[model samples]
Target: MTSRESALIDALRMIATHPAARGLADDAAVLPVEAGGLVLTHDMLVEGVHFLPDDPADSVAWKLVAVNMSDLAAKGAMPLGVLTGHGLGRDRDWDSLFVEGLADALRIFNVPLLGGDTVAMPAGAPVTLGLTAIGRAPECGAPSRSGAKAGDDLWVSGPLGDAGAGLAIRQGRMDGGLASLVTAYQRPQPNLPLGQALASLVSAMADVSDGLLIDARRIAEASGCGVAVQMDAVPLSDALMMVRPDSWETRIEATTAGDDYVLLFTAAPDRRQAIEAASSRHGGNARRIGCCTADRGFALSWRGGAVPLPARLGFEHG
Candidate 1:
């Protein structure tokens, strides 16, 4: 009789009694293990919903692994291996490309393929893929999304909205020649090293799988605080700017667009120097776009004026 949210709460109450669950507030579950801890997370992607039916099978396979690895990055855990659930397609070429793409992702991320299962779906059914990523938590412990404190500065690992633009291209809403945007959508790099550097430094952290505003609001709700983002501070790829004009509307669209697997985290203002240094050391880009507030909601500001929130924050499954 319980709703999905309520059912999740009840299940957590029953199964997350152990201290290692991290109260189920993080992207991955942290369980105590020898010498340190283990971080486990699983993510699923479906055809037509997560990708265009004609999209490249290799890219789809890469996304399936990258998205799961992004969750591991959020936990500040180093990826050890992955288990894949592959739904065999009728097309032999597509399946072969998918394997190649899977191999590419595993090699790029330096993760091993532990094992997995494959099953043939019914004729005309959509393909569904799943990945389970296992990681080892750092000595300081994995970062949680519920640790942001008031006055902490919010930062993002890199630019946003390119993937959204890439999607628009794939949908034929835009002209061609923007291969960077297309590639951004197809191959997203998870900031694993930056996450490890922030494990002990940041108060809270998460990967930007959803819209930036929505993900920020999630952290705010979890930490029981408010967050105000400065629209001007959001980084945008040059490719996106060339396609879309600069304006508040464009900024809003960029922030609310999804599919960017960048890390969003909060750190003390005093740690600004250290954070920047860590980002540089990890060969990652970071920008401070907001700050945590004592209030209990999310806010947006630009040029000393408030920007109204959009009706839809980002891609919604349901």
Candidate 2:
């Protein structure tokens, strides 16, 4: 194994001292929690791949929470705590300020910091963020990507493509609200409450990390069903709306771009009203984007017409 892998495993082992992270599993880890199995998920963010080196500390920290929590929110898991693995600089002050940003995010998410490790990268090629988040299942159940069923109502917590917009502006791809797109990229408010409320309601659920079109396909395949999303129904923020509405390419940008951190869920028509009411109570924005069909085809409807899946799909690693 590489040294980096060894160090990561060792550090994770220490945090396992808690009731949650104990005796980690290699391929996958399972922790016995109080209420059913609290789904466990961890994502490692590399400086360039996940965030730019020039990104602000506060923004970076917020992105960490947004990404890790996205997993739990999709699983209908309640926030428990997060284990942070820090890679710091030789200068102590630089590292301390980073901690402050991370602390700020934890406060916002109401998620505790279980524990983590600290290490210095001599060359500092790219600092990595390792976050392990644990969340309990809802009282009624946990939502799974594989649970989607035919005739289910497909929905997303909010509009799509803000994070992609944020990245575009940052990379000079296009000029727009740095703040608005940034919020979609950073400080993502995981639809935790909505997920919990829909735990028993949603036939299937997943977070929109990789464009709606792509992630929706995942649910469809996993659940052995076909999905049809209405392009006009996909929500958009005032920030993303500024991206040249006349241009179909730009519109596709937001649609295919991922990292919105909203929940993509499917439910029975019978439960739509109840789900909407619950969402209002949770203070989450949700809307019906499409529907699931028994036929095995993934499609999108635009301007009252149906079309094949966009070739863009979503984020692809590698």
Candidate 3:
């Protein structure tokens, strides 16, 4: 290996203190499986696509880790460790900052750095980073997206659109003043505790990464049911509402903006009280915004009137 690669590995060894990591000297991690089961998730971030070039290296590293943890949260699983695939770019200082950020994130999430691979990229190429998160599923079992049934109520762990608005602000498409919105975009907090509390109560669960509408429709299609969302009932943070007008258009934009990592779930109508209690106990503001229907397609309604579906639902790679 080159001196540069070896130096990077040595820096990583400081954070990878987990026994399974083997001090980053071994080719692979040796992890022990939990009795419940293992939950595995992988996510990637690209320089120009997933984040802006001017974004801080530390925030980028946090995003790479948090996004994967969000998947684990949806499964009601406790994180065990993480494996990262880092692309070494021309910016050496940026790489150093990313290592620092990774260490901070691992500590915050109580996850260990196991083992991973690093490779040098061509000069001037966009940097790419990948992470694989390992988690232990809840004893009750991890809820699947296809578990939703007709008559179930759809819920979200928190308000939507903050991250989307933050992106717009970052891109200069909108006015900037709300640092909270910007932080929401830069550092999203996965609702791990809420997910764990609601695992047994939810019929289906998934993180709102792509977009709420698209992710909900995924559940509908997977479960062989239809979902009708009430746009008026969709939750919006005070910060988002203050920045954008509270209208049907704004609601639609928020739902389709993507990058919101809150949990979107479904539960029986009868479980409303239990769900509410769980959410409250976990310090979450869960809101019911829709319901599963016997029909076979997704639909939307605004203030009791049927609204047409948008041309674009969420982000997707071509």
Candidate 4:
């Protein structure tokens, strides 16, 4: 394996503190919850993409925590702690700040620290981040994007586009409340408890890292059903509203921009009451943004009517 691949394997081994972590095939490191089920998740950040060229090491570390936590949120996993694989530059200050930011995230989430790794690299290389969080799912079964069902109602925890707009602002687009929006993009709050509350109610679940449109399409494809979204029903941040009065183009990009880190889930038509109850009990917001249809294709409601969507896609790494 390449050095990076070897690093990944070594990092996995370090975090594999649980029995299930033996194979390391699962996305997160799963472990028994002590009282009951299981919990696990992973978060990865790439330089120049997830962060700025001059991004602070601490901030990058915070993002490392947030992204992984977001995954656990989709699975309804409670924070246990984290294992980190951080790329180090020649500067020791950067490494310290990175750990500090990670510590900040741990404090906010009330999680503990597990062991991790540090490796030196040639200077000026792009910084990279990887974290795997262990947690408690209570029942061992966390939700997956693949479990969505036809005729189910789709919901998102909060507004969309803020994270994307944050990136735009950082990249010098329109700028207002850049801090909050950028913070959203930077330190996403994973809705872990809320996800657990939704466990029995949601048929399928996923974190909206990729834009809602793309993420929803993933769920649809996984469930072998088509999804229809009400463009008007999508949530928006106050910052988004200020800059995007003509939100038409913004909506399209935001719907596809990746890195929102909110939950997108599906519920049965008959389970609306269950959903409402779940939201109330869990203390999170969830709106019926759209529905899973028998159409066998993804569609979106534009200004006047529903239009068929081309193949749903996201950022290309290559």
lDDT of 1 at 155: 94
What lDDT tens digits, residue by residue, belong to model 3 across residues 1-318? 546777778889999999999999988999877566889999999999999999899999999999999999999999999999988875668878999999999999999999999888888888899999999998899999999999999999999999999999999999855899988899998978888999999999999999999999999999999999999998999999888899988998889998989999999999999999999998889999999999987889998899899999988667
What TM-score, computed on C-alpha atoms, does each candidate reach? 0.88, 0.86, 0.98, 0.84
After best superposition, candidate 2 residue 314: deviation in angstroms? Answer: 0.6
The 0-to-1 C-alpha lDDT of every candidate, in the order given, reads 0.83, 0.76, 0.92, 0.75
Worst 10 residues of 1 by lDDT: 8-17
Task: List runs of model 3 lying over 4 Å from the truth.
Answer: none
Stretches of model 2 off by over 4 angstroms after superposition: 1-35, 89-93
- Across 109-215, the per-residue lDDT of candidate 1 in tens digits comes to 88766555556778888888899988999889998999999999999999999998898898998786379999888888888888899888899999999888889
Clash count, predicted structure 3: 0
**Candidate 2 residue-wise lDDT at 296:** 81
Q: Candidate 3: lDDT of 107?
A: 95
Off by over 4 Å in 4: 1-37, 280-283, 308-313
Overall local distance difference test of candidate 3: 0.92
The alpha-carbon root-mean-square deviation between model 4 and the true structure, to one decimal in Å, is: 5.7
Q: Record all residue pairs in model 3 with backbone atoms less than 3 Å apart, i.e. clashing.
A: none
Report the Cα lDDT for candidate 4.
0.75
Query: lDDT of candidate 1 vs native?
Result: 0.83
In the range 42-115, model 2's lDDT, one tens digit per residue, is 98877888888777766777788778888988888888878777775334434544556676777777776666
